[model samples]
Target: MSFRVLRCLFQSTVSLTLLTLAIAPNSSMAQSLPYLEDPPPPPSRTSQRVRRSNPELDEYTLGPGDLVQIEIFEAPEYSGEAQVLANGMMDLPIGGRVYVEGLTIPQATDIIAAEYVRIFRYPLVSVRLSGPRPLQVTIDGEVTQPGAYVMEIPLKAQSGLQRGLQYPTVPELIELAGGVTLSADLRRVEVRRNSGNGKEPSFYIDLLSYIQSGRRGQDITLRDGDALFIPTAERIEEERVRQLAATNFAVAEDSPRSVVVVGAVNQPGNYVLIGGPSRSELRPGGLPTLTFALEQAGGIVTNADVRQVEIRRITQTGGEQIIIANLWEFLQTGDFENDPILQNGDTIVVPRTDAIDSAEVAQLANASFSASIVVYVVGEVNKAPSIRTLEVPTNTTLNQAILQAGGFTDDANRDEVDFIRLNPDGTVRQETIELDFARGIDEFENPLLRPNDIIVISRSGLARVTDTLETIFSPAPEINSFMRILETLGIVGD
Candidate 1:
């Protein structure tokens, strides 16, 4: 019972009381606990995004091969479904034959249901589509894949042949066929369909317009067995014009006794020499002269050297004669005698001028400076090859050398041709030339030809591998004749 012991006990009691007060839960904490009697209500259905059950579809038109179902709840025996016939008419019980050709499924169903109400009392009718409705069309011509395609939307008489189809556009159809190749024309397209009277109606559609402009509504809708034809491009039309022109020129030039002047002239090809008393005294009346031939070939492309002119003549006595004439001297003195008349099969070569030689050397030097100069020629002519180095003569135009090796084959593009000119400074220039043979009088005066120019004569629209092979083999007769001559000379075994 000492005073110190009593004080220690009192202090320990006070500490225990403080510890119990800190650990005990208060009334506010107990009140915050969730009540078992009122658990959280099930999650509200409106909290999540709503999902649509059915997707929106475009309106449909009923046609033949479409199956429609009809049901009458009040009078089951009075209603029955039927398929539309080829005539676009469908027969229903108590509804008779109703034309549903141009009507949508809903529209056709309402018509049939209205017809049934007249027969049955308190009639409750419903129509449902049971089978696929197929709309057929035919595709022909230049499409990569041509065939009949099914139309997703049934078309009425007012619907275009272009719009009712699945593709909905000409460009889409073109894309469906794996896109246009190099040969596709795209300009001229024809849609052929049969009229109700059993006659076929042809509709011309320009795909180029539709593609250039996003006009899907203008496309023709395809129908079953409808034929679509895609023709070639405008380039082919130019070729046709050229061919016609060339043919006419050939006929006109061949009609008169023409002189064949070969070799180097500004324009060294063929010429028709006019004969007269005044000009005849210089040489035989109708013989074409080198000057005349050069005039015809466009005055000898730029670098023709007038200093040295060589003429080769094959004589009748099996003698080969050579003549050298100076055109520069003839020009200065106006000597018609020295300007010899060119005979048939005569070759007159105009040597290159010093300017041309210097230009060629400069070109070579420029080519060597860059070390990346090449030229290539493709299409129609013989020796379609590529060349390197810049030593080609500046005056050597495409026309001069195209026939020098061998002329164009049958499939050569005569009219619309492309020239890809590559400059030494890594620049490219493209020029389109018109080679119309029929209008020879106009075009022959100035034939555009340049060296290092690639003249591409596109393949004919109708050209096929078989046609190319036939063209290649067409020279068999000429080859056989040459072989016979060689055998006569005891050169080789026949």
Candidate 2:
């Protein structure tokens, strides 16, 4: 046999072995290999349906502050207006302060008519409710204002689905308390009611559903002494808000939303946040930026430490989210992205230079917001002695401040100028630098002057000795007389 015949035979044998394995039965393969199936679907994320309970309206009972009018058929003298006192009793001509509270209008009328029978024979009497008392309801949690509200009788007959007599609803109560804040979770509104059996029952209202569907039974009429609680939306997504808005419920934006700017800024106060379309109404200003806020605040003062500007915001759970913005880096890079977008109820605090720290600098950047930022120049300049307290805009170089102060004196030692600064910890820092005015500010060691910076140019050695000699002699008459005597005798030169 040739080599080709041998190779062909080996190939045929290998092919036959592969065919046998491919045609193997499933039972045989199952013994060697484990079975596999696709993974089960993920669990549903849908929340449970909220339980709702509507308050009974037809069986409304009388309480304190409700006014009633009683009329007599034959006699006009018996008809008068009466008010239920705080003790739940009413005074009439026939009945001396009878308890009428907790009784419906018809029940109270029967009691009054029976009392009138004692004074007259077969007196026909009628009772009518004159006015409803203000509903005192307590609202708590997640609302902009949480407290007791004395709401007037808002019940009136309306057309359509609300055809029955309507009273103050949950939405009306929330509106009375300044409406719900941004952190409110409209999905879970809880109303706590006394079951009259000494047990307090809780009813959960899904305001999101009511807002979306405009359902008939969702908005519950609040009862006197009923406690309404709105939960916080701590982990709610923005998409949920949009979905609610897509429904019939209109989401109203907070009006007069103010942001406070405090600390080292020139003016520290609350500035109204001009958001939405109102921002565009400004004169050529597209929006309200940090720059606009600082401008409204009269810009940062000389001692402001822009490196650690803090923007504090309130979270959904009434907690604070502090974001430290470094305006210095933002100014350097000229990046608008570095500046934070101010929100309602935000507070911006610009600390002093000495107070800036690593923790503060790590916040968001919002620099390039200041103008009229002043730096000081003192010591051996021409006007520095008389007008030592001088100020120039921020980023004014060392040489420029010195030149603005009428330049250095003839005896000023330019080589050993002392620069004093304040550290974040309130410690005084001193630096010695050599400067040559002929080289100009750009080409030489002319660092930018910061707020509250102090520059001191020392006097020459000869000038210092001359000043010391003059000071010693001017204060002492005896020393002066001796110097004069020595000068007259030619022993000492004038």
Candidate 3:
């Protein structure tokens, strides 16, 4: 072979080798391979933004049952309303399915606008919360009603506009849940606000300060999805003192102190005495005398055993010291020293006979003083209703109560009348009293009637038997009357 032919062949072989190097399957390192793993997702906005500053958007987060409207400016075909599904996504006409659950109004607008730019030159998109879900709040601990409450706000449309939200205050919500219990610790209340990212920021509130001074900044306005937790009080006495202080009472200062009057007194309630140096200033006619205390309690009744009148005083260490007074002896002998002087927080109890229960001493700390006592007169009373419940003067006697109840009927067994008394220990005491119409004032057998006394001027046995037989055989509408008669006569409880 000639040299030129050999060179040409060599060039052809070299060209073919170069072409093979260029086209025969590029190197695995030079060309990209099919990825077995998923590509990295775009950076999420939730991961980048730590906090959002929109007040209206932060007030309520997108959740199930929330209705929203998306508007694309000048593009009516794509603008429509979409409810957030339970999965937190909504399907739009062109944007398809998009997640807006944790996104605020502004963030949702940005995401929806980004998707619409492919369809329009300038997508002037806007997202609006047309209808919000029900306003719900969680109240935990020491409140009377602790649970989730749905706020019923009337969204009355005014001038073709819906009413704005009336965000409930901490106190109002507490009241709506039946108010805070007495054991609640108001010093440090917790309020947690949702940030829509599984993170809840909390703040402390001093409810006691607001209740005491009506302070402006202490009670904050609560938003939807907010939670309030009132803690339990450690010391109930201290909280009670604070409660009294909040009521404008001078519990610790020079204000008047109240004393409770209970038992057989006419009025069973509290009477106030001037505090400080004037506490001992029981004038010739003032509210500091044992007699004055009795008067404030509606006076001692005829049934009250004056020899056993007790004055219970609470010591500084919460101990009780009781002093018994024999006012009957003092009245008979005309002695002033027997009538003792009353102090602040003293309780005067005029017990009936010897039935006083020592257990009531503990209740004296919170005994309420009412202006009048209620007594029931039944059976043979002249009142049209047959049973009369009367709010009579404190310390009223049986005869006076009967007179107040329109006196007894002709068939009333006055000598065998039943006087039922309810003791503080919840046991009932009943006695049969004999009353002589001609008896003198000193010889009167009528006993004093205390609060909740039941006086039964029952008819004679003949009348009761006649009524019972009439009820069983009359086939009349007065069957209830016959049953009641039987019940009153201790016959048929069935």
| lDDT: the better of candidates 1 and 2 | 2
The collision pairs in model 2 are: 324-363, 325-364, 327-367, 354-424
* Candidate 1 lDDT by residue in tens digits, 194-289: 665579998787655554464543345555456666654423232332222222111121122245544434245655555333444222233345
Range of the 10 consecutive residues with the lowest summed lDDT in candidate 1: 45-54
lDDT of 2 at 212: 62
Tens-digit lDDT track of model 3 for 83-137: 8888998777775878888676667777776666445433566676677666689
Give the C-alpha miss distance for residue 293 in model 1, angstroms: 37
TM-scores of all models?
A: 0.30, 0.51, 0.41
Clashes of each: 18, 4, 11
Root-mean-square deviation of each candidate, in angstroms? Answer: 31.5, 31.3, 19.7
- Candidate 3: list runs displaced more than 4 Å: 1-54, 58-60, 93-95, 152-166, 197-201, 215-219, 235-494
Clashes of 1: 18
TM-score of 3: 0.41
* Position 260, candidate 2: lDDT: 94
